[model samples]
Target: MRRSPDLHLPQATRASAGNLPAFLAACAVAVPVLLAVSAGNIADPIVRYDDYPALLAQPEGFWQKTLTEGRWLNYLWHLRGVVTPAWLNFVLFQILWGVTAAAIAAAAIPPGNRKWFAAVLALTLLPAPPVFLMAPWSSTLIPGFAVLALFAGLALVLSQRALRLLLPVFTLLAFTAYTTFPLILLAVCLISTRQRSLPDLAGLLVLFGASFAGAVLAVYALNWQVHGVFGIPLDPARSPDPAQDLAELWSHLPLLQETLSVLLGKLSFQSTPVLLFHLGLLIAATAVLLRRQPLEALYLWTALWAGMALMTLQVLKLGVTIPVRAFHFTWILYAVLIVRAAQELSRSPGLPGRLARNAVLLVALSYLVQTAVQFTRFRDWQHETRAMAAAISAQPGPVYATGSILDHPAARKAGLHRASSLELLTGLQLSQCGAVPEACAHLPPRLSSPAPEPQPQARLERFEGANVLVFPPRQ
Candidate 1:
């Protein structure tokens, strides 16, 4: 009886068998801590943002409203009615994100590249994109789902029997779940097509096109079902011009550049040592790619360009400041490129290989330290928010809260600003905190006079038969 080829270990990867115990131990220790860190404010009864409360407020047929609003059929939205506890949502979100990241690492990285896999996993836990830790929104998890769907679809296309049958169903669900799925699928298919047979590659390409078309049709059907068949607009209102939009995007490029710099610890928050560690890893990766698979590196560069163009178009159309969460796909691509480069470098003999291994170690260490700092800050914010919510809940009569508590140095360093952070903390169903005017249009009139200055402490006041709580900027 012969075993399947897929089950057989490659000669290069056989050495990793010795490290399996170490990898498993690291995962066992790290995954729970990551979950705990991400679950910072989950225990707070107050909901975070508009969508959750809005959905909860709907009387019946809430799914219709959600569908009409052009929110992709995200799994989280459907769970609104079923999942009662606000914290449960965050817990499920962290778990799903963890599973998706692990699956992608397993599928994308070769067995011989176990060290890169570990590094990718560690980076996945880090708070480079602050929204993943600070906001309990489903959009933060979309990229993780996109990665899972892409890898699973690739397996299906490559004629893996079990995945071939399973992934088409998964693809349909994934495509409907996130608007970003199409762009991610395009990038993944383009990058994964190398070294495959021509016939199989052609089949994969066809599958990609078909899946995209199917996604479009599904969205239309959902819209038509909610609104009437005639309600579906064939041509939506067009933007002023692509040239104008591109110019606007160019003006905002500096903000995006600064964000990238911060993520790499190159600028702001003063983490120069961490920046140097990242530089070492990137330089080693580039050296390995140039020495070995230059053409593959070229393809990766092209994919990066395509991904960035798609993301920029989205930003321009929305006219909102770019959120760090939007860079999720870009991070996934970078991880894949680095892991491939590391694999090639690992096979090198002598000092180059040793240096490459050390670079990986340093990169992992830097991320771990950075993540620890971020977790502490997030936990502090969570505690403050919980206390504020409790105070608000204890007050009687119509309650109105003013000002923002997220003006703390740690929140600013984590890329959260006054407006966005306020939105996340206010407008809860359980608490007396009324929605800020900017978040929801319908709110009880304010009964308290505006403070002489934004308060520096969270305090409750009584005015005009209403409870007014003013949360001051964190001092």
Candidate 2:
């Protein structure tokens, strides 16, 4: 493999300013404060979405099921009545994992490119786009977690240390069942190639693989006990068929065009600079790749494909089907490739590496600044939503809002008892109780119902005639 020439370390005082360990430590400190502040603003008692609702409604049983059945293994097993507290805890841990992954990816960069790598990773984590504008926050958070797991696994595989060799296996098993297949392929590829030591790689492979396989067996056993089935069957409605999902993805081609136009179209001081910044980098990268090579060519191809896949989903009306944050893994990998290419070109005596590095830094920095600004804005808006939820909770009569079309679990998670769009509850009831909507009308108005041991103190009542009341949360 080709490598870069090392410039002598600067004086200790100068080196301190650019220290990787200190920089990462600072990042560690900053990320939690940022996450805490962000969470504080958005973590209202009101249900923002369904996952939270399920966790709050059924905590203990949920945790029990997740531990036994595996993540994504038992969700459909018990249906809505089953809560997955373990999954929530998994999510919280995954978020922390994401921070660690980002730090690792930043660290893997050459010392000189550390700042730019950090910038690129940050931008990937928090992009400003229509998806960010429209999707639920969990949408962002879930994929963000998945992406972290994916990249961390990659880093571990590449590092080839004994401890690191087993990293991908645990990460894949801990995150999701569906994602493990590709990751296994990655592990086997690295192991078989003798890219790293065989003993260490094979040992970790068996250890982690056995653990994952054992978890699967345990989940299968649980399913047999619960529903008399040895397999955890996919829900027909929710099962993923690549062809179908791809078609569903293609339907949003027009929206993709619009979003592209938005990103590349124009920028005002008030508008997000994300589009402009990325576009500039795209151009610069194109220029750098004018001469392709084994290393340079592969990096170019990977980056292109990643971008295309992301943009294709956006265009297909899927509206960012893949988490934008997750795309950072590809971004970081390609960034490494770019640095490598620059190193190769600069060593040839004619071209100035410093000038190229400075130029790349400028472009990368612009994108980084734009991404930070976008994250701050998102944080601000989410704060408003939390405030709104609290204000609504504080009111006497059931509060309504255009937000009522919210995913049911969000309400449940928020600890709100009021039903928005009785249709949702009605459907859920029908699914659970196998009762028809028409049958409800046949029942007496004063039908007796069991009362709760502890009555709910307040609820934002929702009904068909109610108007959704959405207001900015109090400052």
Measured over all alpha carbons after superposition, the RMSD of each candidate to the real structure, in angstroms, is: 6.7, 11.4
lDDT of 1 by residue, 332-418 (tens): 566556666766777757776666556555554555556555545556455656665666667656655654535544344344433
**Runs in model 1 lying further than 4 Å from the true structure:** 1-30, 36-47, 54-69, 113-135, 138-171, 182-206, 228-280, 293-303, 313-322, 378-381, 402-447, 450-455, 463-465, 471-475
* Clashing pairs counted in every model: 0, 18
* Shift in Å, residue 407, candidate 2: 14
Best by lDDT: 1
Backbone clash pairs for candidate 1 read: none
For residue 146, give model 1's deviation from the true position in Å. Answer: 9.6
lDDT of 2 by residue, 1-475 (tens): 7553334533333333444453364356435543443343233211223334343343433444343334442233224454434334333533544354344434333344455444444333322232222223342134334444454434423433443545445544443432232232332223222233446445554655555556567667766776677854543433223334766666656565655454443232244574455446555555555553343343345434534553464345424333332233334443444444454345545655665556555544454365334434434333444454554445434323322222323333333333332322222221111123343332222221112223222223333433223221112
The window of 10 residues in a row where model 1 has the poorest summed lDDT is: 234-243
Candidate 2, RMSD to the unseen true structure: 11.4
